[model samples]
Target: MTFQLRVLLVLAPILLPLRSSISQESAPTTTPLHRIVPQTPAELRELFRYTATRLPIVSAHRGGAGPGYPENCIATFEHTLAETFSMLEIDPRMTRDGHVVLHHDATLDRTTTGTGKLADKTLAELKQLRLKDSEGNVTDYQIPTLDEALRWAKGKTILVLDQKDVPLETRVGKISQHKAEAYAMMIVGSFKDVVACHRLNRDIMMEVMIPSHAKVQAFDALGVPWQNVIAFLGHVPPTDPSLYEAVHQKGASTMIGTSRNLDRVFHRRVRDAPDSLRRDYQMILGRGADVIETDLPREIGRLLYAPLSKSPLGHRLLRVE
Candidate 1:
């Protein structure tokens, strides 16, 4: 071959890899929400710990009930995950025939076209009812089951299962059956429930009510690893801010409920004011909360992602030392 031909061949291998690398870099990729979730318990623990320092986890209250999508419906979940890195707070209730389904209210009158108590209906009966939005307008979405929700959340956002009326055994059974311990967590009300859930599945993550330091100690006493716990401090602004620190020392994170404060008397000054809302969020973050469970996850996520100067509060987010 001539010298010119040999030179062209020498450049081909080098140029090809460079072009391929550029093409891969330029291609659009899925966001963290759409990517496969953490499969191990240790990875999930690190996710929470790292996220606390980065951005506070935004949990959509009632799966983010709004205009088109109804609360606890699959459509709402998909919409939220597509928009942001969010955790869906869903209520699980049992049907009359023992199927676990998602519905916020004990009765179906407020959120669905159906009437009477939700427990009185079977899965088939629940499926027949169309869901309603916050405005009470009927939508085409049907009630989703725990199984469906778990499966859907497998590779998407994390799910915070509010143990509304479902028994611990039922919830644990579903989580295990779906192999969803990495992406699913249940809001346990009592120590008994926490112990029961831990005993059933050692890797099952739990969100427990920890109103005070004593409660934190109680949880520690249970001998369940703190790595699997996220402390829920309730709707009221915590009276003891140190509880956040205390819990952190135990290798767990804390979640503050801002949804209830939206209507409470103490929060009246900040309830309607945009600036005050931002300040309130800053205060919560300053207090060392790792997650903010809100009725307005979309709005909060937007605000949290904004720069410190552009944030409505006009201040930087407080970091836990």
Candidate 2:
């Protein structure tokens, strides 16, 4: 070998470690996690039960994904938990090979490196692809399975599983199989599905749409106790105060989805009137939304962060570090 080649080879080992060190230095560091741990399914229900002093909660829409974090990945979930004690909302779709994996779209083209219908691909095939962030930026994260997410969430954060292609029966089965009733719940769009879930496992909590007084009455008629459900009012605040009062009167907490409304406004005007935007969020809470489900969980969590509640359940269950 030439003298220059020999010298270069000798320096390669030294250069590689320096390069690695630089990468490690720039990598995101995790802070002490802000986690919620309910020891049992009963406690989990009690945690969601509407009360005068209940702590304000945030549900991380699509696991609080952002520029670097891909939605529904466990890593993204952890990153959100590190910042605030928020529950995760994930989409679970079935693969061709019959595995349930976390993916948001009907097609993989939007949120992943893969193309075409996600249902056509096996879990193994999906494992070969990488997930993408909301801005369509390719991320290093891989698609995670429902089982993997359930296992990871046990002592960390509660998961609210969105009904995508996965049937209500399958999602309930996965939660039952994992004994995840303590930290896992499902979103049911209809009262019949809610009833099906309750029949399958009464202990399993559910997020149900009760957007109007009529719907609230219909839900009440279903005879599923309010404690077993968290009523999702809608994407915006209710036009009638009675809607909030109706749900709260049933002893169930309420959730407002701000992803389509307030979250957009927050991101749009955050630089100008941040305080005013924050008040808008507070206004939702003031108007009787016990929970805020948003695309920007970390930002909402920070803005809505309140002192540990004096309520016994809130003190014991609402943990943040």
- C-alpha local distance difference test of each model: 0.72, 0.81
Model 1 C-alpha lDDT per residue in residues 100-213, reported as the tens digit of each score = 999999999999999999999999999999999767899998999999999888767678888888888888889899988888988898999898899999988998898898
RMSD of 2: 14.0
Tens digits of per-residue lDDT for model 2, 195-292: 99999999899999999989988998998989999999999777566788799899999999999987776655566665566556656766788888
Instruction: For each of the candidates, give the backbone clash count.
Output: 0, 0
Candidate 2 whole-model C-alpha lDDT, 0 to 1: 0.81
Which regions of candidate 2 fall more than 4 Å away from where they truly are? Answer: 1-30, 306-314
Candidate 1 regions exceeding 4 Å error are 1-36, 50-54, 263-272, 306-321
